[model samples]
Target: MKAFVLDRYGKGRSLRSADVPTPELRDDEVLVQVHAAGVNLLDSKIRDGEFKLILPHRLPIVLGHDVAGEVVKVGSRVRQFKLGDQVYARPDDLRIGTFAEFVSVKEASLAHKPKALTMEEAASIPLVALTAWQALVEKANLKKGQKVFIQAGSGGVGTFAIQLAKHLGATVATTTSTANVSLVKSLGADVVIDYKTQDFEDVLRDYDVVLNSQDTKTLEKSLRVLKRGGKLISISGPPDPEFGKEIGAPGFVKLVLRLLSSGIRRKAKSRGVTFSFLFMKANGRQLREITPLFDAGVIRPVVDRVFPFESTNDALAYVEKGRAKGKVVIKVR
Candidate 1:
């Protein structure tokens, strides 16, 4: 099997392509012939060792989080899918390797691909879409007629979130450059702030929820815009103690998370608002639930580019630029 292998962790290091042995399937997993894969900032973060303390991935690993492909074989306990099933997933953190020709995924993390989408488009959905679904629908329980501000509306998570929030009937506000104002609006954002010119804090106010995917300064400003009892969910995080506990991090790591988030948590408490960091987990059931929304045309993928499998490095670099209007994909098959 031809795969891109990360030999070491460092900033700006490119993955080396090599022939590796096919992965052996587990009792609860599926071997998928990769058709396409999604490139995310999380991929780059892991490569740069930014997540070493939390994730601690071994050296010489294959990297990719989201995958869309056909199931070549299923594990003994996998009854939901079989050979030839078209599926997509954000594989479990420890098992991710979708940047290869074929990757094995846990059955519990796999979902049937939405019938309306192409393989590339399906690949783009799992990681970012699941992040949005977990943030808005699961955590926030956002309802119709409420107000929510989703930062970076033109980015991967933002594009999906804006549409999902609107589908949930919330009035959505987002931040993007002037060039992307119409893009976010077309995605159903009711309010679009030009981050290059206007400050989002000045324009958005008293919102029910604020999805913060930006810097500490931006996160601080986001807190001020939320009304009392509003929810502030930071995906680009200062991981809170709750999140550390959820991941069952070591005591020292949990203490680090507590220290890192204490100031923000205090500020949120002073304002009577709730704050938590969200590190989205892979869930097949949630993806299954949202499949209908994609099929029903309530949410659509916004793919900026599809790089050939040979250009996987280029695809990662493109995503690292942080200017893609939506997701970047690698056509692996």
Candidate 2:
């Protein structure tokens, strides 16, 4: 099997294409012949060792998270799929490479690809879409008619967050550069603000939820815009211990999380709003639940660019620019 292997973490490191042994399937796993993989900032972070403390990985790791592929083999306990079944998954951790010709994924983390989408488009949906679904629907329990603000409406998670928030019937407001205002609006954002020219804190008030995917300063400002007792769900993160516990963070990770979130939690409490950091978990069940919306045409993928598999490095660089309007994809098959 050919894979994009990372020799070490650094600047301007390109994936070295090489022959690697196929991953042995676990009892609850599936071996997938990857058709396409989605590139995200997390891919970049993993490559650069940005998450070393929280999610450690060994060297020469194959790096990719989101995958859309076909099942080539199924593990003994994997009854939901068989050979030739089309599936997509956000790999449990950075260790299982989706940037390869084939990868092994836990059956519980894989979902049937939406029938309406192509392999490339399906690959783009898993991580970002699941992030939005978990943050808005599962964590916040956002209700229709509630005002919700999503920052960076044009980026990977923002694109999905805006659509999912609207699908849940929330009045969605979001911020992007002027160029992407129309893009976010088309995705069902009721109000789109140009972050460069306008301050969202000044223009919007009393939101039920704020999906924060921006920087520290922007995240702090998001708290002020929410109504009292409102929630701010940050995916970019200052990982809170409570949030870590909710997601089953390890003991050492929880200690680190408590220290990291202590300051932010105090500040949020002073503002009379609640703060929770969101780390999206891979769950086939949740993906199955949301696949109906995509198939029904209520949700659509917004792809900004598709890079050839050979240009996986370039794809990461593009996402690192922080200017992508939606998802960035790599055609792997």
Candidate 3:
């Protein structure tokens, strides 16, 4: 099996391609022949050791999260799928390796690909779409006629969130460059702020929810955009105590996390709002629900580019540039 291996963690290291032994399937897992894989900032951050404390991985691992492939083998307990079933998934934390010819995925984390999409399009949906679902549908409970602000509307998570928020009937506001103003609007954003010229804090006000995916400066500034009792959910984060407890970190790590978010928490409280960090997990059931929306023409993929399998490094670099209007994928088959 040909795969890209991350032998060590560094800021600018490229993964080395190798012919490793094929992975053995577990009782609740399935072996998938890779067709296409989505690239994310999460992969680049993991390679640079940005998540070492929260998500520690052993040296010499395969790195990827989003996958759309076909099942060639199934484990004993995996009754939901069999040979020749098409599936897509954001595999579990320690088990991700879609930047390869073949990868093993837990059955619970995999979903049937939408019949309306191609393999590359299906690969682009899982991670970013699931993040939006968990944030808007599960956590915020956003309703129609309410207002929500999603930062970086042209990015991976941003593009999907704007669509999902609108589908839920919320009036959506988002920030993107002047060039992308029309792009976000086409995705159902009611208000589009050109971040290069106008400040979002000045323009957006009294919103029900704010989805934060920027740095600390942007996170703090978002407070003014929301009304009292508004919810601020940050995906790019200084992890809060709640997230620390969710992951069951050590006491010292928990204390450090509390201190890291103390300033933002206090500011949010002073403004009569609530703040929490969101680290989305993989869920097959949520993906199942999302698939129908695509079939109904309520949502569509906004893919920016598709790189060849061998140019996986180039794809990562392109995403790191922060210029893509939507998701980037690698054609692995």
Residue-level lDDT for 312 in candidate 1: 96
What lDDT is obtained when candidate 1 is compared to the true structure? 0.95
Put down candidate 3 lDDT per residue, 1-333, tens digits, no spaces: 988899989997999999997888999999999999999999999999998888878879889999999999999999999999999999998888999999999999999999899999999999999999998998889999999999999999999999999999999999999999999999999999999999998898899999999999999999988999999999999899999998889999899999999999999999999998989898888989999998888998989999999999999999999999899999999
What TM-score does structure 2 among the candidates reach? 0.97
For lDDT, the strongest prediction is 1
Instruction: For residues 39-101, write the lDDT of model 1, one tens digit per residue.
Output: 999999999999999997887899999999999999999999989999999999889999999
Candidate 3 TM-score, C-alpha based? 0.99
Q: In order, what is each prediction's RMSD in angstroms?
A: 0.7, 1.4, 0.8
lDDT tens digits, residue span 244-286, model 2: 6775778988998999888878989998999999888888999
Query: How are the candidates ranked when ordered by lDDT, highest leading?
Result: 1, 3, 2
> What TM value does model 1 have?
0.99
Ranking by TM-score: 1, 3, 2
